[model samples]
Target: MKKIVSLLLTATMVLGLAACGNTDEETPETPETPGEEETLTGTGEGYGGEVTVTVTMDGDTITNVVAEGPDETDGVGTPALEQLPEKFVEANSADVDVIAGATVTSRGLIYAMKNALDPDANPWPMVEEEEDPSNVEASDVALGFGISSLGRKGPGADDTETQVWSINEVLASALFDGEGKIIYLNVDQVEVATPNYDGEGMPHLSGWPGQGGYNIDEDHDEKVDGVTEDTEENFIAEVELWKTKRERGDDYKMGISTWSEQMDAYEETFVGMTVEEIEEWFEKYTSDRNGRPLKEGSEDAEDKAKYDALSAEDKEMLADVTTSATMSLNDSHGNIIEAIRKAYENRMGLEITEAEAAGFGVSFMPRIGPGKDDQDVQVYSLNQVFANTLFDEEGRVVAIHVDQLEVASPNYDGAGMPHFSGFPGQGGYNYDEDHDEKVDGKTEDTEENFFSEIESWMTKRERGDDYKMGISTWAEQMDGYEEVFIGKTVEEIEEWFDKYTSDRNGRALKDGSEDAEDKAKYDALSDEEKAMLADVTASATMSLNDAHGDIIKAIRASFENREVINLSVN
Candidate 1:
């Protein structure tokens, strides 16, 4: 009877449809019999571990699902299994979604099916839900990195005081992500103020009489009635010079005759700056010490102005260039280490000997040499590189041994000049002291012209003293005289030289004041006069300049592309 009733209703519905739709062109596709979505199955890679899930469905609804895990814990993964089945059922008409913190497992289950048996079933709805994987809780495993010692000190508190220097540097490196960094730190501990002096380093401070002002108040009759204070009369005079040398590195080498000149420059230029401004400039950049922009609200405006000042291609090039605060933190660390080392040496009663102090000077200390895991006791310093060597009381070098040797400036050949082996355009040259090598008709290459062999490679139009003689001589010798001479005439060359000399002379006339006076002199030169100082070395006729710098730069840039070949020495 139920079949008969269904037949009658089907017939009536067919008749009604036929009567109504004589010419109906847009009709929904016929629906097939209800079927379950086929469960998907595949291996899924996850940060935590790999997982596999299987699902079961009925018609358009998911009746059941099971998730299996190899590494997943029961308590942690059970939540995923429990919540996912319900989530899957709730999204029966739509694609499956992954739960936060259980994304891998949720996804593993949802994607387990190859295709939906139900045509309306959506494939992946987790994307729309946007679940976060970071929410998953997990135990953190310790990761280790290489560590090297930064400094040295005695055992116990003094040792800690010394080692703190290196530890601080490591912390700083970790914070900065390493743009420019010091290789390592040197540290030492100075024991001061024994019970005899009641913790006030009085005797130690009083060692240098006029070096440190000693005030003895005999009338008061205190336990230790003497106090030494740093003053103009006895203070470490020119602490400023020491500071400048440490910071500038090799810029402060001075002659005794030029003492007045240096003092005058320091007084004039430094006097204009307030202590606050000086400190600010000297202070290194740190994350905690970040400062607001000079024009904070108008940063976009400022950027636009800068952008407008440059070409489109330059703007694109600059897009990759990160403009951020460059910290002098490394210098600060060096300063701290040097100060501590000096103080410690003073305490040890190890007089840094005269012979040891011969050239520039050297410090004495127990140091570990390079290529040693265990400390190799030795003395080291920046003497030979930056200055001369110094010896200690026992006829041994009092140099500070360092893990890294950045200032290890080994001298070049017989000439006492520092070696620049790794520098571009510096290598590949031989010299004869007593020769006036002619470049074309001019005696341009002399022993003083070191980079003669590499002049033809440079591309920059405006060359420097490094190129002036060497390139011209090379061009003449190489039968490339016409090539070199095509650019500028003899008059033009003379004019360029005159222009350079005139500029320098003008600066000299103003007493080389790094102030408004020097600027006034530079501004006084006419445009035509300035134009005369061109790189006329390279004209259509000949190259007065060598392109060695350009060649070396290109080689350096393409270094990454070069294939490395390993040859077995052993």
Candidate 2:
């Protein structure tokens, strides 16, 4: 994205009126000695344009410098014209000083100083590069592979742009604010061929339905008419794909059905096979249809020859597959899961956990085509994802998908479907790991309900974050266990629990305080339970620290928005 500059100026006028009044007063004031005007001029150029200035003052500080030129880069030289004092502003000028990278602009400013008095007072140019000892120190140490692998390596300035644009479309909402949408479409088709019959004829692939074996293209009218005679094996398979487009607002969500069986077959069929075998199978499969084979030799040879004619580049290109499939996944349910993952990533400030990654459900497509004839096979996968959210003062995801997930699920099942297997016209196995009852007979609904319970507690107590409520709930539960839960030394808490459970016959802790063990637990209640806990006691403290870290991150973001250098024209 190109950087753009815009300038806005606001000025206010005030008028005051006073009723007629007459007063007689006599006062005399003597004129003091006129102070000498110490004149100082500075010219500096910054990231954008240049400005020059001359200040007339009586002290070490110039106190004021006016600038005129093309718009200066915000947060840069503009500070010189604002709140900065005279000494620093002069130091930032070209004749007196240059604002580093804006040297030319700084010179331009100095040249513009003709408007000021005392041309002979023009200061000779002195460009002194400020020594950044930090950089020098950094260079002194060898940042070898060990350090680089730790992600401590420095990146070029353009790397930030790349990160922004890697998933630019998704970030569009956050960056561009819903000016455009990113969509992903997927389509799948099979590149199938029959196996060649060796001297020892191989068993025809007819054991499974939907599997390519002993099958014929009944639609082949010429072959049906018996006009072609040939004998060959055939290989048949199904291809899945998808397509994504940026359209409408960002809230658009699309999905499709995927049959992993086809994928499984693909893995078994072509993934590990040599190119020779693939071609042979294509020939034999295309030749033999039903019980009859098409024209032999030259036709098959023509096909093989055509394939051979492809340049190495063509072969390399052909090996790739790209396509898309898109369907309205859930009209209003466009929260493409990317945001959830991002929230987790930002929250944790680390690579995602495997559980979180698995829940993300993002993948790629293998091949794509309009149908089968104009098949363009290219591997497609989800790149960077983005979302735009409309919040009301307080930040919260209201309308999701303000700019949905845009991925290129080419030539694969872009549709979010798991493997399906069951008796034909009957129930089949659902391979959806996310389906209800995924965890210990618990479904998404169960988790939702659990969170809902927590939410109820929050609403009742007016707590703002789930972590707060979760921690409170855990603290309450721990109340009936045996320790002064408040600031109890870690050892004390452990000891208390051990003593409380010493004679409990190793029974799991129950939810009431009817027994002696329960009373001991209740007596250990803390006034303020771990209000930031996410799991159990030990984990709760860690969670509180994590929440604090999140708060610190937000603070840092706020700090970054503030100007690094304070400038005033005084």
Candidate 3:
């Protein structure tokens, strides 16, 4: 009986040992096999609002990460969100460096990633609250104004050998928050040269592009009349001699210099400065020939030393360049500053002194006509006009006006008659004879008579004058086209541009249907008018397209910068 009991105990012990080993093997096998990728999403407070991050892991290894913050500012917090995903994936961990300017957003992104990796983990420390000075309120407003000019010096009586032209565009944007503090200020300038010439031509001027008879070598050494290179001391001596000659009223020309290279220096000084401060600087510096802050014994030791190192002749040359630059600034920035001030006043409903309502201006001079060919050089001039309405908080246009100014040289034919080229001047239409009228009282041409003739012709044509122009009068077509843009947003206007401006297959907005008045007017036009209609419509369409492009560009700039902008309906 004792032997049988002992055998039963041994069997039980063996069975228990087998069961333990099996359980241990199965437990580890279940977790060892690779499982499906796990994805988790978490959100945390960011600079603007909740920032979300999604993390995907394959077993214990991080596979992918994505973060998004829609409410963040474009150039600030947005950059942090864009950069954090790569860091999370590479480290296979949530710890990462915070972006410099976007600390809150960066920390939020990291916290969200951590949460995604371990949902049950303790939450990250809350971001410390800090006052934001740039926070915008509903009542906050900003005003921006852009102006451009194209100036041309026509062949004058004394200096008729060459023509000179310059184009400059300036944009002044000022942001005033709800607290009436100018939080942001940006001023940009773009200067474009004319097509062919490079500064040197008639009147023998002494400035950039015109060498003033002085030849400068690559090392900036100056020589005159094939003479040997002048030493720095000798150059200074010659300048001193010239000063004596000038004191005695003898005319002498100095080497030319340009202020274009110094524009950035001038721009840097204007930034972060108030309008009054900028005006004061302008008044002070522009009055003298320096065109900038005085460099002699400047607060910046480097600048003072550099100025001291320059030769006397070089110093004088720099002064001349600065003087020219300051003069240009007076001519250009004065208008821009005044425009911006008026724009601000208009936004606040203050009394404005300008005749027209506040609006930005853009001017471009595009060379039209034929390319270089020996014969038949085509002459063309294009003046583009863009008008945008400025709206109040209620979406009501507070200011609406159109401005037309003649800045560049007018397009003239060989006979000195003003020629309207492009789509408006199809068939070489003569403006003078085409509008002349022989009245009972007077025979000479007059503005009233000219317009009267055009109106009479249009009226007669509309009344079934058998002049089949295949189009309505220019006045009717333009009025109809302009009506299409009323009350439309900038984006909406661009969307509808092609539909209204197309002249293909009589698709122009003014090209009438079977029973439309425009169709009847077009069908009743004379053969000569009919022949001119296609070309005229084509030209007008081109003009409308170009103007629309410019207007859209201006409006987009305003919107992108988060400013209140509108287009003029009238």
Per residue, candidate 1 scores C-alpha lDDT tens digits across 313-412 of 6544333221221212223222222232222222211122122111121111111122111122111111110111122323232322111111111111
* Residue range 1-570, candidate 2, lDDT tens digits: 111211111111111112323336533344554546677665544234345566665433244566654566554445444433353455633245434323334445555453343344543353455543211001111000000000001111121121100011111111110111111111121111111211111111211122223322234321221111121112112111211222111222111112222122322233223334434534443222221112213345644565566577654443321011122111111222232122222220111111100001111212121121113222222221121111211221112111112122112232331111211211222122332322222112222332222112111111112223343532332222212233333244344444333233322223354788655653565533322111234322211112111211222222222211111111
**C-alpha TM-scores of all predictions:** 0.21, 0.19, 0.33
The lDDT for every candidate, in the order shown, is 0.28, 0.26, 0.41
Quote the positional error of residue 500 for candidate 3 in Å. 4.9
TM-score of 3: 0.33
Tens digit per residue, CA lDDT, model 3, 1-570: 544775798799789777877653543322344657998898876766789988888766678888999977677688789898998899888888776546557867888887777666736444455533332232334443333332223212112222322233343444443444443444444332221223221111111111112221222222122322323333223222211111212121111112322343454455445566666655543323333433344566655666676678756654544432332453522244543443334233212111112233333323233221122333333333333344344332243322222111112222222222111101122222332321112122333332232222111112232322335533344434434444554466566554333333323334454646446656665666555545545534423434212333444333333333221221
Error of 1 at 548 (Å): 29
Q: After superposition, how far is residue 25 of candidate 1 from its true place, in Å?
A: 39
Worst 10 residues of 1 by lDDT: 168-177
Score candidate 3 by lDDT. Answer: 0.41
Better of 1 and 3 by lDDT: 3
**Model 2 / residue 549 / CA error / Å:** 31
The residue ranges of model 3 lying beyond 4 angstroms of the native Cα positions read 1-133, 136-165, 173-186, 195-278, 284-287, 294-379, 384-408, 411-491, 500-543, 546-550, 553-570
Candidate 3 or 2, higher TM-score: 3
Ranking of models by lDDT: 3, 1, 2
- Compared with the true structure, the alpha-carbon lDDT of candidate 1 equals 0.28
lDDT of 1 at 536: 30
The global Cα lDDT (0 to 1) of model 2 is: 0.26
